[model samples]
Target: MKISTTAQAGALESNDVLVTVMPNDQGGVQIQLETKRVIFKQFGKQIEEVVRGKVSEMDVDDVIIKVQDKGALNYTIRARVQTALERALASGTRD
Candidate 1:
């Protein structure tokens, strides 16, 4: 339900969804989300750049997000962020 320590401290992987993780210079982390869209995918990169936070930053670390998306919608992206965060939380290990 919350961001798992393993997920937070591991690499990113995906099958249908493109997963990517980059360690920030600061002791923070971020998860970027996007559907299979040319334009949205481009913006997703930028979103990753600005998005920054630690699991502790969230008031509660007990949540996972699963987004049903067609193209990369802003709402969808946000949903995916939560979904992926949740995925990371539940996932025992980050591969």
Candidate 2:
């Protein structure tokens, strides 16, 4: 799938994650992540893994994902990413 516009889901509230997605003209998936300093040291890789996994699963080849995590679980992260991607897809121009 291709992301042709910017979209977002979730919130910055505690235990939730804010996910933003946009088109990447560079032709690859790029992710920018943010979280608490302490939590990043421990679970940053895991959180990034979940995001990457979801993007891969959706077959999105050219997009940028920005994740702001507020101590969210893996499921929450996945859901937020999926929702953002779905919205982007829906808003994109059809080929």
Candidate 3:
């Protein structure tokens, strides 16, 4: 799916993650992650893996994903990313 505009899901609350999806005309998946320094040091790779895995599973070739995590679990992160991707796909022109 192609992301035609910016869309987001989830929030900044504890145990939640905010996922934002945007069109990436340059191609390929790009991710911008935000979290506490400590959390990044500990779970940064895992969080990124979750995002990339989900995007790949959904068959999206190009997108810009921004993740703001507030100690969310992997499932929460995946769900938020999926929701945001769905929204972006729905709003985009058909491929």
Candidate 4:
């Protein structure tokens, strides 16, 4: 699935992640993640892996994902990204 426009999902609440999805002018998916947790250095790679996996599973490509992580668990990240993608696709369809 290709992202047709900019979209977002999730909240800034604790233990949650806010995800923003946008169409990329270039090729392939680009993920930008931000986290303030002390364990970020250790868990950053895992977090990125989860996001990439989720996007690929949705068959999405050539998009930019911006994530603001608030110490969320892996499941939370997955859910947020999924929800964001769905919202983006749905909105794109409407337009």
What CA RMSD would you report for each candidate?
A: 8.3, 1.4, 1.6, 1.1
Q: Is candidate 2 or candidate 4 better by lDDT?
A: 2
**Worst 10-residue lDDT window, candidate 3:** 86-95
lDDT by residue (37-82, candidate 2, tens digit) is: 9999999999989999999999987999999999999999999999
Estimate candidate 4's alpha-carbon lDDT, on a 0 to 1 scale.
Answer: 0.91
Candidate 4 segments exceeding 4 Å error:
none
In candidate 3, position 25 carries an lDDT of 90
Lowest-lDDT window of 10 residues in candidate 4? 36-45
RMSD in Å for candidate 3, one decimal?
1.6
How many backbone overlaps does candidate 1 show? Answer: 6
Error of 4 at 29 (Å): 0.7
Model 3 C-alpha lDDT per residue in residues 1-95, reported as the tens digit of each score: 67778899999999999999998999999999999999999999999999999999999878999999999999999999999999888877654
lDDT of 1 by residue, 4-57 (tens): 432222122332233333223343343444445764556655544323332333
What is the lDDT for 43 in model 2?
97
Clash statistics: count for each candidate: 6, 0, 0, 1
